[model samples]
Target: MSTKTKVPKQPLSEQLSVGIPDAGMFEDIPKIRRVAGDSAGPRMKGKVVIVTGANSLQGIGRASAHQYAHNGAKAVFICDYSDNHLETHKRELNSLYPDVDIHPRQFDASNEAAVKAVCEEAIQKYGRLDVYFANAGIATGAVFTDIDSAEFMTMMRVNVLSVFLGAKYAAKAMLLTSPSKPHPSGSIIGTASVAGLRSNAGSTPYSASKAAVVSLMQTISYQLAGTGIRANAICPGVIETGMTSLMYEAARARGTEKKIGQLNPLKRGAVADEVARVALFLGSEESSYVNGQAWAVCGGLSAGHPFVPGRLS
Candidate 1:
């Protein structure tokens, strides 16, 4: 609701031109022919992927599942703690991609047994687990000193431990099953946040839990090396998801809405799809050599200080 506009230090086009080659030079090259927009690349074709926390209407999990299905994944297993909402998301996805297989299951990501059972169920139904996005997370707003022990434990169990259980079970399933003769084996992606990278005022428990996700990803990547299972974390900035929406609303209620998106160099917030694309890239073979990395899809918000209008010359 706050209309404060913070201009970025540099524009996207300028940044893109600096790093990438001119497309005109490759326009006439036979190897550079552009595929039709409607075509599904073989990158994820026939693969089975599981995504957690996909039931939320404005979360990255839903967006990632849709992208995976659109990219020709054979089956997309959606797991969430909410049965009714999960069914709704499953119905929507199935309606959108009638030919694609969409499997919806009710399970709590924080529960180790539930996580393991879901992984096994997906493998039994789909034959193999190719991609797993451990995206289920919870956020709580509390000052570091005043935070209750129980609240801290809940955040850790849901945000950090859930990722650990997901990676453990998903990797176990992937190791037991062999990959397609030509395609690579498997990938595990965890969703961290900018909070994990930097301190967040009044969000100590949430930030600490997200930080744990980064550590979990690094440890999992190292442990899964040589097993054809790559692990990575997607560190998204303030996207306009259900969780952030609540935060924004709370800020508005407290007359502090102007602080939203203030830390990002990019003045505006990102949509869920922006983060989902990075998840897809990490889950696909295009990033075959990319492992143990935290890909930040933050619209350059994390690049530098935001240029406030009156504060700057």
Candidate 2:
């Protein structure tokens, strides 16, 4: 025989109440503010980095540049094909982090000569190039029938060819400066997309271009083997950048902004800074062993088809 303590029961209403809040509750979720990394210390100290596709004030390239500066990168060359916002971006970042040298370059990333020149510029100016983020690319949604051959070629030129140039030239620069560092080392990061991993995220050509980008990183990582340099691709899901501004605006106009990223487990679209954080991680020494991989920053969307919590479909 065992003595048992009396069990207390909750009220029926309390027992039956659902723990999950309604989706409406998400409307008031706070925006993610950009700040230095958790420690707010010099994490990328003395590193020199290049970030392409950085003209947009609200883009991952600009955000990554800021992240590098915030973490004490000695130099950050922010390049873009468009010169329109490059100066403005430079000013804004300079105001926040005066110590970080921010160079604004205007050149088409798809042009092999321009890419090579920028990489050489970094090596010439800084005597080292630790990271090169090949982040410049376009977004499109035209379906297969609507897209003509020229359109497909344009997409490939801007997206696939650019990353190829980035890897080829950035690797050369890194190799040139490897002896100056402790080891033959560098990091090359490309901006792929969840669309590249599967269908439904982008138009056919766009998805193909991104898939090529992912494959490029994987191939180059091994090609650069034993050199200590790492190559990786970041596959972002639904991020709120200039590329997706129209989608966000339309959603807001239709009063459906809260539903922006419902397909993902997190149920909210991410900002550029969120993606930038991952770029910073790949660029830092903490990820020295992280190589030849495509990191999905998709808020668990890539884990599988999102399902309702506590239930199976």
Model 2 TM-score relative to the real fold: 0.84
- Using all chains and alpha carbons, the TM-scores for the candidates as numbered come to 0.81, 0.84
lDDT of 1 by residue, 185-217 (tens): 578999998778766422888888888898889
How well does model 1 score by local distance difference test? 0.79
Q: Which residue pairs come into collision in candidate 2?
A: none
Alpha-carbon runs more than 4 Å astray in model 1: 1-42, 178-184, 247-262, 305-313
* Model 2 bad stretches (over 4 Å): 1-40, 178-182, 307-313
